[model samples]
Target: DGPLARLRDRNQLDRADKARNFALAQAGEKYRECFFRAGLDPLRTLDPSQEVKSAFSPNGLWRCESQIENLQKFRAAREAIPEDFREPLAAIVLEDREIVDVGREIGAYKDAKMAGAVALFILRRGLTALARHYRLISPTGAV
Candidate 1:
């Protein structure tokens, strides 16, 4: 019983180490900053036990048509952005095209810097559109 208990402890320690390393590797500075600002622990969030859902879930959004619909909307919105707003955005798409391309490939490394950059672009554009919808920003994208 003692030997078995020791083995279990070692296995748990190994798993915890692996999870920590994986979390650290995946959680870039942007993600860490966001987590810190939100008062959340990035490490705990990466734990498998704390993971809310599995990729194989039958009801997961990625497995549904709604996901495709949402992606289409995202694409349309991206395409609809005015030239002025696109000027600032061009730097990211142009400089980090490879990174963004890889990030978009399969949603792999969700917290990667490249993925975060792409997400940031979407979020900034979404906010711009939302502000426009409310008339908070001009059509030229000025606040």
Candidate 2:
């Protein structure tokens, strides 16, 4: 694969793995929030799409998506609620938000978790941006 293609594959893999990770994390966060209402330090962990990443299954996010597909029951629920109610969508938006944040944060921080679009985007914008900078400074100049 070309560098971009490899990056895309890894990032897509990471996104898929992260979908699973974020689902479980948010679920645990939800359970934990029930008691303390979301403290400062959220948990962090690696992705789980590799051959031997972990023994435990990573299916919670898929399950969560399946569970949430029942929102058809609320097709009219939005009309019933008052205008002051905060939430607008029936689904969690973290995925897209993180995707967009990837472009933004990577442009700024150069290596931050917030960059989460295509796998290549993550490679350039998230963990590898600093390395990219150094590589650019080397003989290649980002060829």
Candidate 3:
């Protein structure tokens, strides 16, 4: 399961309203979509045949129009997030990393519990901002 699913299972999202939950899910899906479209997934491996050079694009560094648009959208969504919240959001949403790992990486908490809590909070706020940027949620309501 993903971080969001784990959060829901643990009732961490109990305080969030339906709209906020939907917005968060939408933001996450969009982020993942853009991430894959932009060819930024580190885990994806290209086949040898796919890697072979062709006459059309010898360097194999070509992007379709849709990909270009998604890349722009990805940049816009990323920029919409606050600097403090960006890393955690990307860790959980894009890389599927655990919140505790993210917390440990940030290194500001005295305990693991506190670190996870802070990381979760940062991720939620970042997702909210992204939802607003994508118009999945309103700026002033239910965020």
TM-score winner among the candidates?
A: 3
TM-score ranking, best first: 3, 1, 2
lDDT of 2: 0.29
TM-score quality measure for candidate 3: 0.79
lDDT of 1 by residue, 1-143 (tens): 22212323444212445443222222222222332333223243422223224543545323555534544443344344454444333332222233344345435556677674554444245335533543455677444
Q: Write the per-residue lDDT of candidate 2 for residues 6-94, one digit (tens) a residue.
A: 33445442355544333323322232232122111122132211222233236423224332332222222223323322121111111
Position 99, candidate 2: lDDT: 37
| Alpha carbon lDDT of each predicted model | 0.38, 0.29, 0.73
Which of 2 and 3 is ahead in lDDT?
A: 3
- Give me the overall lDDT of model 1: 0.38
Quote the positional error of residue 141 for candidate 2 in Å: 39
Off by over 4 Å in 2: 1-25, 28-98, 107-143
Taking the tens digit of each residue's C-alpha lDDT, what string does model 3 give over 1-98?
Answer: 88866775555643547657766767877887887886555464432224423532456654577755776788788889998887788888877888
Q: Between the candidate structures 1 and 3, which one is better when assessed by TM-score?
A: 3
